[model samples]
Target: MDVLLTVVVPVYAVEGYLYQCLESIRAGLTAEENAQVEVIAVDDASPDSCGLMLDGYATRHGDLRVVHLTSNVGLGLARNAGLVEARGKYVWFVDSDDWLPSGSIRAVLDKLRETEPDVLLIDHLRVHENGRLQTDASSPMLRGTVTLDRLLAVQHTAWNRIMRRDFLTKHDLRFPAGWYEDVPFSNPVLLAAERVEVLDRVCYHYRVGRFGAITATRSERHFEAFEQWDRLYAWLDATGVDQALRIRLFTLMISHLLVVAGNDSRVHPRRRRQFFRRIAGLYRRHRPEGYQPPVGTPGIKHRLVAINSYAMYSALRTGYRVAGLRRRSTERTPVVSQDLPSAPQRVQTTSLR
Candidate 1:
């Protein structure tokens, strides 16, 4: 039987969550549907027994294919390894720390058969450590007829979308190495696709606060987002996107950078001003001709960046933080929080965006 979908899972130090992640893909699939799906799990030189576990699991499951790498290649290149082995009509990259919701695969397959889209976007829930699930703010935007600009407004996570094999190959949209790799890859995939469709359903359960998860950890390497966005700009120039698209992408780039800057988990408090200054520099460099900032808080942020006023930006962030604290205090509700690294300002940082 011809493969309809290939689910690529890149495994690293996720031994605790690997079984659930693998099982979720096959959970709601029927026998016939199972035959049409292929799963490639890449063991990226994990120090744990994940490679051995994958080998054992592949022996028991005919649909599972395991790729053992000689050395750790990080998340992006590990995914590339799995992609090289993908043979299905469409490829979906599933993170080893996340799992699909029940019947998600079936729903995806149905949509794939119906629309035959070059790219398919799906909604996902943020599964907190406390087991609470929250819908992404961008979920509502996924509905209706989605254009490239609208799709770009949504999150750029690779796991939320499936790409037709030929579309990816034709564009040569391989993941780049290093953090924030999705920044370049996901946006370009949406831009390059001729036919894109939205599933409009919560198909993925993205686990937050997972131990050893990149986003949940604090590190200086978060600066990699800058380099990644630089690559995206290079792609935009190479593709010769229209001015309208450029304006939209520029807005997204600043918003994403602000998120990185504000997230205390990602950026050190002492270096946040430095990061904001860098964001301002990018804003000045990439601001399209005749570009007008959007209205409201985001507009104000864009203006601040344009002027390179890190002090004003910091004040704005502080104002919002104060308002949030007042609002939460009025409610007087106990918070279920993740275990963050011990720092003086650690308690203040929790999903600013």
Candidate 2:
């Protein structure tokens, strides 16, 4: 039978939630769609029962297959391995820790047939430990019709998206083995796609503030994000995107730096200066013509960076610490990528939390 979609699940140390993820996948696909759907679950050397659990599930479902890796490879490489075995016309990358809503796969398959796009973007809900579900505001681009110009404002995330296998192969896209690898892998493909569609329906649940989640951990490995940004720039330069797209991409890059150096509480307070300096250097290196930061916190950081005012940056950051204002850049520093934890601040679990 011809396969309609191949779901690639990369598992690593997600044993606690792996069962829910896999179960969601199984239940979402109706029995009628069973033959048309296949799952490629990669156990990336998880030192837990995940591999065994996957094997057990595979035994029950002939359409589901599990690949056991001999050694521990990061998420990016594990995804690359899954791509090697994908045999469907469309490929969906589902994180092992996250699950899809009921009947999402069938809905997505219907949407795919509606317009065979190069990529289909689905809406996602961020679920916190407290059971708080955050559905982002309705997007104009996702509604009615979308254009590349409008998509410039939309962020490119790896998950909650389905890509044509041939489109990905044509672009020769591969996930890099490092932190924030999504930047390089997703951005280029999104920009290169001739037909991109965004669905407003929430299909996936992205969990935050969950124990053992990669995002929940703060460490120097976060600095690897900078390398990811550099890779993104290199790809953009090589592909020769239009000037408008280049400016938009640069704007997002600048915004990421501002968020990391200013508002992200994961950064160590001692390393805030280094983070600021790095952001400054990036802006200087990649600032495109007619570049102006978006109004608000990011714009403030841009003004400070323009003047090379580290003193202003420090003073503003200190104000945020003392005033206890959220969403303001220059939060208690260390920015995880620094390879150090915040000495002044440790994990604080409050009653409300």
Best by lDDT: 1
Q: Which stretches of candidate 1 lie over 4 Å from their true place?
A: 334-353
Decoy 2 TM-score against native? 0.87
Residue-by-residue lDDT tens digits, candidate 2, 179-292: 788889888878888887766666787877777665666566767878898999999889888888888888878777666665444566677677777778887888889887
lDDT of each: 0.86, 0.77
lDDT per residue for candidate 1 within 271-348, as digits (tens), equals 998898889888877788878888999899989989989889999999999999999888967877654211111111
TM-score of each: 0.92, 0.87
How big is the positional error of residue 265 in model 2, measured in Å on the Cα after superposition?
Answer: 5.2
Query: What is the Cα-based lDDT of residue 223 in candidate 1?
Result: 87
In candidate 1 the C-alpha lDDT for residue 9 amounts to 99
Cα error, residue 149 of model 1, in Å, equals: 2.3
